[model samples]
Target: MGTERDKGAEQGTVHYSGTEGGWGSVRGIVETALRERPKPAALDALRRQNKPGGFMCVSCAWTKPKHPHTFEFCENGAKATLWELTSRRCTPEFFAEHTVTELKGWKDYDLEQTGRLTHPMRYDHATDKYVPCSWNEAFDAIGRELKAIDPKSAIFYSSGRASLETSYMYALFARLYGHNNLPDSSNMCHETTSVALKDVTGSPVGTCILSDFDLCDAIFFFGQNPGTNSPRLLHPLQEAVKRGCKIVTFNPIREKGLEVFKNPQSPKEMLTPAATPISCLYLQVKTGGDIAAITGMMKHVFAKEAERWAAEKIHVLDVDFIEQHTDGFDALKAHVDGTSWEQIEQESGLVRADIEAAADVYIEAKRSIAMYGMGLTQHVHGSDNIKQLVNLFLLKGNIGRDGAGISPVRGHSNVQGQRTVGISEKPELVPLDRLAEQYGFEPPRDEGRTTVHVCEGIQSGEVKAFIGLGGNFLRAIPEQERMEAAWTTLRLTVQIATKLNRSHLINGQVAYLLPCLGRSEEDMQVTGAQAVTMEDSLSCIHGSIGRATPASPDLKSEPAIVAGLAKATLPPNPKVRWDDWVADYGLVRDAIEETYPEQFHDFNKRVFTPGGFYRGNSARERVWKTKSGKADFTLPKKLNSWGTEDKDGRWRLMTLRSNDQFNTTIYGYSDRLRGIEGTRDVLLMNPDDIAAAGLKQGQIVGLASDADDGMDRQVGGLTVTPFLLPRGCIGGYYPEMNPLVPLSWHDEESKTPAGKSVPVRIVV
Candidate 1:
């Protein structure tokens, strides 16, 4: 079934040509720029973005090009920039006019749309409104509340918006405060990639760089949509297609970005009807069927190799690389041979022929790159799903080479950098010994709470205090209803932010909204106008210097705010100069170099390099740091990532992002690529499934989770709309669909919420 292009579409939905970018994207950028900033300011921000001596785009982790364009920013990047540099302000007067309780009733979009925060506000329980407070006063009050509770009881959460310097200081503060509870945004999104890749490839980050796309013969996309998540990636995909590179996409929905891309930057393409076709082949895999489908592909590769070897003395598989650089081939082969075709087909929701067709493309390509997003990582067997893809790459020695490696498209600008600089719940992941030596304090070695653990802590009352370093933490996680209720029980809640979000309204006993400078705003310090660094998905680190004026003169940089908190909370440690580091960010980078000498050698100098320097991956160089001292071929415990069977008429529901949205932040009600507009409260389902469930198109329905967790998780007022999807599979926007995902329904190892596959039943 397809979206109807009739009068009914005007009510909520519309059908457009399944093409991304071109005039539509240009219109989006223009509308956003005009809405958020003055003409000159918007034009200036766009030109300076992703350029040398300019701020990095706060949208996605896509790397900047070596030879920069006139405008390096994408549609979403422009929206993010304009949104940050918006003239609208959420000032003390605005807060005084609206009570916290009243503001909680506002929509997510409306709350953020109120605009950038302009003051340090403290929640006044007596008046039920946030009142302006001095920075010193806010810090003193927060420090007192923190001292009253066990340090372990406080959760220090971070978002990817923070730069490397800010993240480093935050981590130091948390470690010195006697806990490792540094749960950041990565815990929710790409934790699976870290856990899975580390086990097999020794590195937690992707091995490929931006230049790899130029040499790759084939590109395989698994459950990732570049149109919304990372639009800058479309340029490389478009370029690769023009160079005769084959692109294969395996997703539940045929993403428009992967189908065809009309470069908005290219005047020739924009003026003409010509558009670059992206994906050579697109396979609609089931919501939770990545593992089964990937396994089926591997099965085909092995069969082809065996047939080739028997017919002619030819070896299709890279036997030499497998023997020298990898292990567990025999076990992987045994498992593949043992699995039946029927089982693969049933779990994958795709016939063997289609699976083989995709595998054939993989087999033919001499050099290939495997890339994926949250769709493959946010599942019960998310790690296993990733490992299966690694196994496929290993079969043909696709990794550790030019134009061939695994790439996990990170969502946020510096999420990878945050983790690299020690924003993690895992104690061993960070350089604790070096941090201790550098700061002259003993660091905690205990494992800390993840995002999921933080939720449990909140619910159980163990987490008394919560500190967020830029994000709507309460609204972003699963079990929205439970979180909103449990949030009120906290003694202290501090949100260091650039804008007013829903999380700011969910007041604790004592809540403080600390306004900080955004990426677009100049972060003036004691030294001079400061520059911070961010690492992209390609592991390239570069400097970002804000050029726009600060939204509020009272606002401080994130590093300054973090240092202020540290000074207020902890006693003076002469070895650790918090004020000096905040005064000059170069000192922070120097400390980072000292902590991780190998990775950040000459950190201050190297980060400022033209296109930035790559923090080299050991796996990419074929030097495995795993316990086995080589790349390992691992098998998943189950073919089906979801624990439950496809019985009782339950449908597998996956949460997605609209083209107009980024993470939990909504830009608008429209999703132009998917032909969705005017609403975020609709469910996209296969027509066959809709008919079977006795549901008509555009019918309003409620969805209740089939999780056995005893929680009656449900989301109502959803309009069911027909779309192209596998049988028994459905799609909906994130955070809205987050209610259907149980807090406990997560990946077994990573504890990342399986937001992609929630078993649900329609309620009339």
Candidate 2:
């Protein structure tokens, strides 16, 4: 019983809003995406852009500049642009007029409409207003406060967009300060993929690269929509389609990008208007059923391969490659052979025919890339889901070969890169060994808290304060209600960001909002204007120099902010030049070069080459890093999860986004695909489930979540609309229904909140 209204901003439907086709809404979406408000000077600012050494779009960590393209803008990219170039500013005076409580009441969209923050503002609870203060005083307060505490208690967090320069200093400062409490945005999204991949494949990063997409005959996309999220990826998808390559999507909801896409950058495509249908086959795998679905596909393929070979069919699998490179094939073969079609079909929402159809595509394509996103990794069995994907690739001999490998299309441009630059909560023996060799002191080998651990600790009063480098900690964290309560227990919390947000209002006993320069803004240093490095999804390292001016005089570079706090709180650790690295980003790159020689070779100079270098994906040459020096074949188990069907009498709430929405930032309230307009209060339930619940379609149903202790989190004001989602699951926008998610409902291994699967009950 949630708001089940029609917010249908359907695909390829052009709204008659403006000359550029509601580009203002498009631009607003862009601006809020980057967490900044739109400004009058946006277009002019963009017109003057494309400067030689500028930092690339701080949006989706896609590859940086190569050849001349008029606009490298994707959907999220344009949003980042509008926010960065916004005309509004969330001034201290504005905060003075409206208390944090009042600001908290404002809509998330209205909160951002206040414009770019210009200064370090401290909330004066006595006066009930945030007051502007000098940078020195702000820095001094941090230094003094940090010096007073044990370094272990001081946790430093970084978001995905943080540069190599920033990440290096962040880790160095945390280690030098004596504790390795470096929590990051990765803890929320791909940690499962990273952990699972590392254990199975011997590499923490995804094996596939951009060029790998070209060679793939069949591309299996599981629960990832590139159309709205990573729009730039559509280029390769379109290119693959044009080349008659095969693409199959496994998602409960049909993502628009896969359905059809029109390239905005193409003059003919944008002018005359012809949208291209991308994916050839679509599979509506239930949420959290990817493991079963993937295994089902492989089961069909393996069985067919056996049958074909038994019948003297010459060319089914890459037998030579598998025998030559892989290990434990016998065990894998048995495990897969034992799995039943009845179980796989039941769990995966696909029949035996569906699996065979996919296998047919796989057999036809000589090379293939299996790409996935949060859909696969945001579950209770996330790591297992990933391992299953690895199994699918290994069965086809996909890894360590051209045009075939596994790719987890990471969100944020540098989520993969941030991990590359060393922002892991659990840095293994290698990182510790590197740290010991360079800094002369051993890093604490014990693993620290993940996202859930941090929040749980906070709820239990163990976590002191949340120091977020970037990204919305409260909104992004699943189980919003619990996270908010956890936030209130903190003694001090600081956020280094580009704009105002809900997290600012959910403060600690002593909270500070420090404005930071956007990636497009100039960062002047003693050496020169500094350049920061970022890693793309493909694991390529490159430099970024901001062409735009700082939004506010009081704002500081993220790296500089870390260094200032670190220098004041920690002892001198010479192998790390804290001040020099902060003063000139090149110094930070030099240190990274010293440690990660395998990847960041000549880390300083190479990034200037424009196209930026790829970080040696061993899969390119069929180089497997597993124990046997080859990709291991994982045997998947039966799906014990009944999935959405099992949640009878209980609601299965699936988090999604409006077309106008990007990540946690809701730029506007319209999602073209779902027919939702101007609101996130609606729910998409199946017509059958609606009748089962004794409810009418499109009526308000107050959703109540079942607690582990048999209690319910009664969430009010949700409109329930009986639409078409899978049975037993109701689909709705994320962060809005985020409150329905329990903090404890996270992937066991990754600690990533279960945004996809949360049990709830509804009543009118």
Candidate 3:
């Protein structure tokens, strides 16, 4: 008998050499969408995605095209949206069947499959389950907890999925409530880019816009896989290839995206069978060795420029741009000259000839853009790694110009917007005087706990309450076991989310699951259906209107939830009207404009326009605003040896996401890109390394980290698989491998955990 197959079920491993984003991606999207949503529902969502006035995809922060196609969303974006709009419901009946204990035991994907949270849930100790509670009752209980604790003891966390309006209200409410402990997802991913880019370019945001890809002559991708992380970027790369623009890629693993790309959107390419080759030169750099590779390239450039100077009586660099717009070039030049090729090649795992070749590409191109991702930021020297790339670009006058600059690809949809809207622990970034004058309260102006610091505070009993605007803090932070345990000690833990996650399972003495409206759900207030704004990676602020009906009628918008909680929790102030702001989100934008007048002039009007407006980065216009009034050439002080083996013969282990997932959210059991199916509990290791370790394929092994920071870090029962990785390098799925990363193993300046470079040894 012929049987209808279970398409969701996994089969076996299948590997292929074809490029990403072809008919296969289309199939994956259609399969996943149909499985989750009905044909009409899925079609409706696709039609509205990334449209002029439609809801934004709550995935990556890739910029939308000015004139977008009807089907602007990619495979992963479609997967994310369908997952959000799933028909499965996590109602009170579902909770009645599963206790917190049993729910914790389920897989991350199974928990998600239980579906959208239907109402506000409160933990019941007697019932051992979450019971429905009224919004007022939940807020009142939360207010009691806030009133009982010292404001300094409460830690406020924000996720990148939040809109600019919600994040702004949350930040302001937290500060007014008397705490400045605002740590967000940015602290985990691109905090290094924000800190380091500011040091070099005098602005935190990158200098390049999306349009720069059209004008650039070359692009050097540093440790990024565009196929899965940001698939929309492949279109620009395809166009660049057609225009003869060189694309040089540096990554430890040879990702399929960097090798080639087949754009399904292109009619000409779709008619004929052809793949656009992405990388002209692909270099597999050693783990945490980007600084060495970049310095080696700079060394070659300096040496070649000397030869050019002698021959034509002119330097190879843009001498005028360098002399006028930069500072500290001589010191940086000396550092590069002093570095030896032997040491560079040994550390970088790249030959001098290849480094010189990449350098030649950079030197000859009139304009070039360097793009990097978490691969470059999740290191002990993460800030230094970013600064090195900045220094490389500055040498050739690449920044602050058309088609030439630095682009640090961010992870979340609005992580940059969250930062722009005052979600920071740094006192310097917070505008105290303006906030105090406009809002009738003194904003906290002291440096507070960051994500790493907040973890320490939680473990040390200094922080008692946690309010997460969005995100799974338990799975996202380092030392997962320790973090999960610490959350149990909190007096109050609140999660504003749409679905079930690990964070909601581990509760404090008093816990609340406040189900909030998703970006796709229409947010109706007293005024009517209100729209929110989100800022993309290129600093383009645009409105996202939710055309779909609310998944659950009981769910409240994030702004409403924040406002309701603030009204109940905050001290009585006749001047500040929380209810008024909740009635109309326009008041929130108007407040944001009043607070940051220089940046958000005519905010309501501009956001309603076609594509919104640019936030106006001074660095993008070549206007240096550093302390010295010029872009500075900074040098990394010491070479980082994060992933190098110690006396115990440990290998460098990096935590990465499976293609079936995003951050901590698991979509399915298979990683479709790598052809790994049925499971994610496998280690990717070099064949020679596996042989030397006396390990055969499919052998289950235990792994332990080298860090002795009073934490027992180990991951057990991981099946070994031979892969195309460099010698002494191993790979595992993130959050699964997170237990192997010690909390203390982090960047000094940025405080970002070195998830990309953990020293670990496999146990038999």
Task: Write candidate 2's Cα lDDT for 1-764 as tens digits.
Answer: 01112124222222222222223334545545455544555554454333235556666765544653566566666776676767678887788789888888888878777878898888787876789987777777877777776666667887788887788778776776666677787788788788788767778777776777767788889878776677778877888888888888877776667766666666666666555767777766767777777767777777778788889876476788678877778887677677788877777766778777877888778888888888877776777888878877776678876687878887776777777766776757237788788988867766666777777777888777567888887888866776787787788888888878898888887888889888877788778888887887777776677756677777888888888777766677676677787777777888888888988887777876665777786655666666777767765444622223464577667788666756776676766555556667877777667777787756787777764556556667777665546566678777787777777777776777777777777767
TM-score for candidate 1: 0.98
Whole-model lDDT values for every prediction: 0.89, 0.72, 0.85
Clashes of 2: 38
Residue-pair clash count for candidate 3 = 0
Looking at candidate 1, what is the lDDT of residue 384? 93
Q: Write the per-residue lDDT of candidate 1 for residues 1-764, one digit (tens) a residue.
A: 11243123324333456468999998887777666754356567778899877779999999987777788988899899888888889999998899988998988889888988999999999999999999999999998888888999999999998999999999999999999999989989999999999999999989999889999999999989998889889999998999989998888887888888999889899999988878877777888888899889989999999999999978879999999999999999999999999999998988899889889988989999999999899999899999999999999999999999999999999999999999998998988887877888899999999999999999999999999999888888999998999999999999999888888888799999999998877788899989999999999998998878788899989999999998999989999899899889999999899898898999988766777788899999999989899999998989978867778768899998998889988888878888888899998887767788888998999899998767798999999898877888888888889888889888888998999999898889
Maximum-lDDT candidate: 1
Tens digit of lDDT per residue, candidate 3, span 1-764? Answer: 00122111112223445568888788878777666663356567678887677888899998887778657988888888888888878898888888998899998888888888999999987888999999999999999999899999999899998998898889888889988899999999899888888877889988788789999999999978888888888888888988989999888877777777888887766667877888888887888878999999999889889998999887878888889999999999988899999989987888899889999999889999999998988888888899899989988889988899999888899999999989998878878788898878888777889999999998999999999998998888888888888888899999999899988999999999999888987889999999898888888888888867777899999999998889889988766667877888888899899888888999998875555578889988888878889998888866553634445577889787877788888877667677677898999887777788888889999889777554568899899987767677789998789888888888777898889989887888
Worst 10 residues of 2 by lDDT: 1-10
